[model samples]
Target chain A: MVAAHALTVDDMREVRAAAQGGRFFALFDPNALIAAIARSGDRAAFAELFDHFAPRVKGLLMRGGASAELAEEIAQETLLAVWRKAALFDPTRASASTWIATIARNLRIDIARRETRSRLSQVYEILDEEPPEQPDATLSGAERDARVRAAMTQLSADQYRVVELAFLEGFSHQDVASRLAIPLGTVKSRLRLALSHLRGRLEDLR
Target chain B: MSAVHRPSDETLAAFVAGQLDEGLALVVACHVEADPASRQRLRDLQAVQGALLDAADPVAMASGPRDVRAAGQGSRSPASAPSAPEAGMPQVLRPYGLGPWRSIGIKVAMRRVVVPDAEARVFMLRAGPGIALPHHKHSGLEWATILSGAYEHEYGRYAAGDFDEADSSHVHTPRVDPVEGCTCIVAMTGNVLFQGWLGRLLQPLVRL
Candidate 1:
């Protein structure tokens, strides 16, 4: 089983490096971890997941412009959601990281919508829609995850940066262009090319 | 479904990022429900999100409440309502109450969908075969998903399960398919500004 206590930032880096070094298989098994929580309500499994994911979720929220306090709060909520929804996690659909990241992203969005609802109430209504159904079971979660990582590495620096800003930072095309000191049309074309490339690379899995 | 209209990459990115307003997201959800390809695309986008999260620099947070067992047991049930399948209503939309269909123009009917705490207006529009909507531009973003039948605009043909995203720059008159009438769910962030002499004359009468 993975370690059960909270990990410091340095410890997380070592874990991440190990994951990159192909040592992850021996140290952690996400499917087994989730199964433990699902089958026996194992607090150790929950702790392992929380220790690994909570800090990463907070970092992601902070990158998306959330305050530190807000990020921590959302990260806590995300892990709680993981515990509550452990039974629903199907290893066939998505990897553990992908599944937990989605919960964190959705919770952050919910908080943002609640904050903006009143100010934009006359112009737009917040739609608190449910999450999409289980992903198509075409490719194994590990295979898809590896392919995506490979495809991302193949992208040109500019293309990658545009995607990172747009997806990770939630910046609009215009905003990305302004931030990168590039023309708006260039930003659009680069993003378009990047998406097409990623799609072309990942389409075979379907 | 493969040939059906899809939202642009920018819109898809925004949707995945949770930046889209509720009304637009609803229409996109309906499209996703009907298209497996879109669902796959969503998964790919989500994988990118996962990678970014993994590589993100962690910041130390002061410990607040660390009791997962206590917090996890309190009120974390999925807010799923009983399935109430309705014709032309996507499963994601069954929770909201819809108003009565009112005549908006010739052979066109519309019904408002109540979405709380939303600034964008959500509604459903049904147009008869060969019916042409007035040419107009939008003040902000306008998103629509065809529920049944099809429509042809200046851009391209949009069939059932297709999504159409219109901004202030778009100005076109969409005509329902000649063989079958078309029905679409739409969420608009702002009012539609009618164009031309006839459109100006009828603008005050048309609310959408």
Candidate 2:
């Protein structure tokens, strides 16, 4: 089981480096992983890829209020999507997170629609024009990097990890509980507290 | 920067994970354009998510677990990409004057667009004065974003760019502006639950 904690900024950089290291089998980069999955049906590459992402998918689902079981199911489904659609993984358009997020978002929409049985509703209505307005004071990519890093620094190690697991990796409350060998209620409580704390701290950056 | 209101954290979380319907998403887009605070929250959420992704440990696959890799690596024909252009307001769904508003129990002009390969569709509505839609629940997930005018549902009044999401369980009728007409965009997936005879009759017209 993966450690139930968020890595410090330096640690995160290391993991990113490992993901991009390409030294494990061949060239480092997401492209290599895509190539490996394409050229050789590389289980290792896919595993590496899964290791990096499944949690994030889980995080997204969990934050959206899916139960732990649902988050796990979604994570597995998302990984399967990554596997089946590996060839479609283009580095352009978005990074891996954006691409995966798109798939996750679509999948969630599908599940939500399926459950609701709303076939009569339209999908995305086209607007006449792209609104000229832009997001207000969007953090520069670099500033975003800095602020997030700074935010992460404020979290206690345990709280940070829980936040990471719940938000980034999509670990369901149950999953986190089990992984940490804690009670499910404890997991939920921790998550609630951690999110509350993070929300308070991140607000300062705004 | 923009006049749009940001979505609630719960909705933003859903959007970040791709859970939002298109109409709801459009409203969120409008809000993101209008509200910097919500935009920053979304960005922060995304950034934190990125950090967590980088930190996750790789799970070990069973030995000889190659079958799972087949879909990504092996020769497989791509699914047909949807023919419709990417999501933005399109003129195709525009209707001159109001057609009969079906489920919502109002007289409204309606236009629609279906995504090519994706499991989503979009609808635009222009409800006439004092019109109200039928009271119906959803068959699948549904999203409504007010583009112009305003309407009231169980959740209260929604003005242009206000978003509401409904699932199979929700039921409401958006009463058009008591005086002014209401224009809105809706994104729907799966089927719709038509509540009354009018809804049943108009059900056929409401297709994704």
Candidate 3:
């Protein structure tokens, strides 16, 4: 039985390896995969998405200071959420990657907050039990995304660093300051400038 | 819509990253509901985050359950219509199960929201026209979003859709406009420390 299980694991690994190689040829479009899952509970489409996003989500959570085990758990949960919320995905509003990233971030936050609440229940009383749900925003088109991407390249090195630390690593302002060995005020100003520049470049979309 | 006071970029970014505490996020959610411009900003920020996700280096996931067939079977669809808020209540605050409003001062009433994981005390405060709240400073973060009417503090006038964020460093005494009473949802992290003789005298009587 143990030998059979090992053989099954090896077969799965081979399948995944083949899928990874296929990425170079077909360049899987997450948007189309999401649409497939939404229209019909397409297991193949979901497998493709799971293969591509699960690991990236895990990496992001790990970078945000979660333990490896916790990160993996959240990553799986994030994909589960994507599957559950697929019908709500309006491709025109957001790309699949962005939507999935949000699910991962929110799950991590929920877990962290729950732990904190349990630890500090005696000192701090939280009255509301429900988590805050993300608002559905209408995202711009692909053209706007390209423009915003172009605008990002125009940010100063310092500004980009702040944005990277804050957004990608989920660092707080103080965390960014201490990580970069800069004053807290400096971190704040740099981040503010970066956001303002990006907003200005994308204002025409509005 | 243009006049609606939006949260700062940092706060909004924090909201996008899911880093803001639940209480503060709720206030931002309320603002986003009333203001389309802020919602647009949120989308823009989220798109940027999406691009970041795309650029991230992929890590190899460990082999696990390969069954994707029953993945979402037990999950409810997200297409269902959001339940309508109680009459005269904002949709964002409907989920909290607010308590009965009790008189906190003359022509002023407040109701506490039951948020289980929040370090902050979330509540709704309503003041009659021309009523003035005693001057006070917060021990930590204090976030208030105006629901209706307008109030003027030392900082400036805050009207409907305005989100006022304050910390321990700031102090203000707000007065409602005489023409219209003001109602606000507030999430406070720490106790309020009243300033001056009158404020100190009233502080003991004030439960919030």
Candidate 4:
């Protein structure tokens, strides 16, 4: 039973090798749990989701520089949001981790809004939540998730770091630049190149 | 109809990454709303973010599962439709109150969009047919989304549903469409310094 996670390049290589030549990866089913909660307001399902994600969400926040208290507050808030906004989840479009992480990221942006004065408040803009239906709707969430994982492994190390900082870490380009010790234009170009590449690869799914 | 112009990919990536501030995000969202292509583009970028999240290291929540579940009491009733604001504003803007339109220049009317805690001041601006906005430059970044009609500047033409952005370094005059005029939702930091002596003399009169 291969767990459905790859935290480093070596792991990603192994995952990709397994994924190549059409092997099966029996992953945990967070989507079904979210769907169950959405359908029946299932407390059991919510508890399971909490057990699985609360810590990971908190960890993600802490990596981006949130305090333990702040990360805990937001993690709790994020899980509670999972309970409240479960109905909005579209299993066909995103995995449970993606949907829940998007929520946590939005809540973090809300914190950023409260502290600093910037243009970031656009949460719950349905455009932020409702993915326009994909060109092809038949793709399973896990299949798409795996395809994305494959694409990540394809990116050059420099390219991948930019994507990771901008997306996973939710760092502003300026923050990414300073953290990577690269020029702002370099950050922008790398991200632009990375996204264009990712988009091109994912477009095959559509 | 779809927009011919959209926010830059870097901006859209930032928008997808949850880095764009509320005002700029709203502007890009309007374009995303109006353009299917942009919407798909954002989805593709977000897919990568989601995959990265799956690999993110776990930082244990201080509280146990049961305690974290207790954060919100009982059921939150479903949200109702927001109060109606001015028509022609994006559906997302319905919750925010729109100030009355006040004329700032010949055939120009502007109104504030009260985005709670938004540091960037935003406004809905209308320019009459064939009218050119005063030549000006910004002290900070400015993002505008055309709601209806069209406008043009040295950069290019932005029609209904289009998004345009300019920063301190950009200085040019923009004109309302010749026949239809234009109304755009704009967000910006700092002030607009109207260019030229005539613009300076009238700056006090044209503060938006």
Which of the two, 1 or 3, has more lDDT? 1
Candidates 2 and 4 compared by TM-score, better number = 4
| Per-residue lDDT of A49 in model 1 | 73
Candidate 1 structure quality by residue, lDDT tens digits, A93-184: 67788777777776776666666432221111112233334435567656677788889999999998888888754577788888999999
- From the highest DockQ down, the ranking of the candidates is 4, 1, 3, 2
**Ranking 1 against 4 by DockQ, winner:** 4
RMSD in angstroms, all models?
Answer: 6.0, 10.0, 7.7, 6.7
For every candidate, what is the interface RMSD in angstroms? 5.1, 8.0, 6.5, 3.6
Expressed as tens digits, the lDDT of each residue in B19-125 for candidate 4 is 66676677777778777777766666666667766777888666775543444433433332456645556766755667888776667777777775665666788
Clashes of 1: 9
Question: Which has the better lDDT: candidate 2, or candidate 4?
Answer: 4
Residue B134, model 3: lDDT of 72
Docking class of 3: acceptable
lDDT of 1 by residue, B1-208 (tens): 5536888766777777766666777778777767666777777787777777777787665663367666553233443433465775777676566888877677877777777666577788888999876776767777888988999999999998999988878876888899899999988776443455224543565455
For model 2, the stretches where C-alpha displacement exceeds 4 angstroms are: A1-136, A149-199, B1-6, B19-38, B58-106, B116-122, B134-141, B166-173, B178-180, B188-192, B196-198
Model 2 score (lDDT): 0.54
Candidates 2 and 3 compared: the better one by TM-score is 3
lDDT computed for candidate 3: 0.70
- How does candidate 4 score on lDDT? 0.71
Estimate TM-scores for all models. 0.82, 0.50, 0.82, 0.82
